[model samples]
Target: MMTVNEVSKLTGVSIRALQYYDKIGLLHPAEYTEAGYRLYDDTALERLQQILLFRELEFSLKEIQSILQSPDFDRDRALDQQICLLTLKKEHIENLITFARGLKQVGGMNMDFSAFDTAKMDEYATKAKEKWQHTNAYQEYTQKNKGRSKDAEEALARGVMLIFSDFGKCKDGDPALPEAQALVKRLQAYISENYYQCTPEILQTLGAMYGAGGEFTENIDKAGGEGTAKFVERAISIYCK
Candidate 1:
């Protein structure tokens, strides 16, 4: 596990910015020490890499958070897109360098602005953003959350965690127990009512994420207890079947 200071030094992201990312739910550390210092694992670092790449593409923090949190988010696919965008940026820069060098050699006005055009890069970025942001679930979530107050949004988040807290209470018991199954039902209903439709497929994906050892797991375990996320994932798996 790496401390927050280590992460800052390694990634060159300011400690303050990391703190802000935590505050805004952009990037959460893997865990916290008893003394309340943040600790991160490889998974968190990988997430930070994704954030940095998106930032290089000029994506806003909000956009990055949304893309990362999306149920449809695919790390491999995102990396592929980031690589393509970076290559395009590199090509644009090389073109500009060549253009500048030619102008200097000629020592006269060359008025060739073609090197500055970024239409290809811009088009690719727009399409990528649309793919990340316009998923049917995301569109529904956006429509449902339109005009919601910040406090209301937070309250909804708290409501979801409270369900996880209930899951924590039964972590030691059989996940197929009636109470556990009931909690799964409640969770599905709550998500369908608030965020997006909690289809069995989506819920299964979310269950995997809950135990996947990152922010969602950390937050769920924080709400419940250690192993709570995994227990919930098991329960959800049974419920889905």
Candidate 2:
């Protein structure tokens, strides 16, 4: 068994946070020593690891507590989902960075599409196609992106993120405006071009996910500035409707 101070140092979670978790019954130590110290066994340490994972995914402590206490909680399934979501986050961050770099190269008013080439993108899309080939939701994407060129794929990612930045500039604009609708159309077409054929149903789901407070949401927010994710969701809602 390890003491609370030891667990704090090992896990980088503050002793105060751990104490509060114990107080709220979120995490309980394995035993109490004669000196009134908290002693956590290996099982407790493992549980704490799971809690940190959920926290990293932006789950509120209450939500995490409920999830852990639920009879249906599956650690493996949860970890898998988190892994997929975080991977998407990393991809979005990279795409957003590429978008920003493009702006620096071509000036903010006009984007030089050539800055993002096709070869790298095509390869990435090919990899995505392979990854999702067995999934029915991405059949169209898989088939369309097969043997596609790298330049086309790269431009699609850059173009989409740039549009997101434009959307940030339109925070006050109506989602139903002609320009906004047009942008959403570009978004749909871009996805269909570079990744999958994003049907209205899929686009709507993506809009919601962009506002869902994970990496996807953060990516859009970063590209479009504050409130961009929700704006995109609202715009997509109208566009898809």
Candidate 3:
């Protein structure tokens, strides 16, 4: 058991914010002591952890409460998802900083958007690819994606995009219907064509990763809308089963 102050100190959230959360029922204490002092237990501590995660994800307090109180709420899953998002945000910020530095190197008084040339991008790709080839993570990704021709991979990507583009047009539970099932089959076939025997577990994990990670979200959302990504995730989940 811990007091509100203890939780504030442990989490680096201000004491006032913790008190406000209690008042708003966002992270209420387990019970109040006889003297009216708030008391929190293990469950409350865990809830606080979730609230902190929402803050890090830039969710408003109201949004955090709704998400936490949802039937599908899962702290570990939320944390895992936030970690993926933060990682992608970190990478994008780094890239932007590097681009800014490149502009500075070209003796620009300010960010010279005009100086940004796509034609010069190929000059950096060789070094970037060489660096990735030497990294364990890139090597693993390469081996995982190997054996598929570039053209075949591109076609598979297109098939997946087509499914995303048409997301949410069908009625609820339509994924089990003939047309939806056909789409799922097409997606499954694309995976099989690109990779060596994508197992059921692999398919399920890929769905989770898609929801958890920002890059996957960006790609799927670009294919259609944000709902399209969620629909793809649900379809993948059902197909994997």
Candidate 4:
């Protein structure tokens, strides 16, 4: 058996982090000392090792917890899956390193990207499906946004980006000014033009998501600047209200 500190040292994780894991029920101690110190037996250590390995392979904490705690989880199957993923990652990283080293040697750029491994492309698609399935809001967004044409959507998108760009210039928490309101109107018209029958409910929900969701945050930040998405979202809320 090992104390929490010993386990932390062995795992190279902080003692505080181990304590947090224990608190969160992610990796509880196998035993407790008379002095109330946490202790980990061989089984607990093994579990910790698996958790660490899964984390290193880019599984989220929640994903790891679900997999570990699931009734159908098999140790051999888990190990096999981890090995497959890690091998793919290793191959990709090796290719990137080779490319970088070659670039360093050649000085000027004449590199071909045709050697890109497309074998793991389906992994991202699977992950995206799983992510969309996890949230009703995101699923709804996907349903609404999916299958919309590029040509039809581009005008609306341009209008929305302009609003976001203007919003980025404004101070946070300030009331939506006349110019913002006018932009919101244009955005609503654009949505109506594309969405066939844009209901207030759908518009309101979308506006709320744009205001609060990290997806919109990233989108707006990418387009204009950080907080531009939030500002546009707020303005949409005001206009819709």
Report the number of the highest-lDDT candidate: 1
| Model 1 per-residue lDDT at 187 | 98
**What are the models' TM-scores?**
0.84, 0.44, 0.41, 0.47
Worst 10 residues of 4 by lDDT: 132-141
**Candidate 4 segments exceeding 4 Å error:** 110-241
Instruction: State the lDDT of candidate 4 residue by residue for 39-134, as single tens digits.
Output: 887768877887887675566765565555432234575566567767777778888788888889988976588447645834843563364245
The order by descending TM-score is 1, 4, 2, 3
TM-score-superior candidate, 1 or 4: 1
Residue 169 of model 4 has an lDDT of 68
Over the stretch 2-76, how does candidate 2's per-residue lDDT look in tens digits? Answer: 999999999999999999998766788877999989999776887788788777665677656655543234578
List runs of model 2 lying over 4 Å from the truth. 1-133, 143-155
| Cand. 1 TM to true fold | 0.84
Regions of candidate 3 where Cα sits further than 4 Å from its true position = 96-241
Superposition TM-score, candidate 3 onto the true structure: 0.41
How big is the positional error of residue 60 in model 2, measured in Å on the Cα after superposition?
A: 31
Q: Tell me model 1's lDDT, rounded to 2 decimals.
A: 0.88
How do the candidates rank by lDDT, highest first? 1, 2, 4, 3
On TM-score, the stronger of 2 and 4 is: 4
Please report the candidate that would top TM-score against the real structure: 1
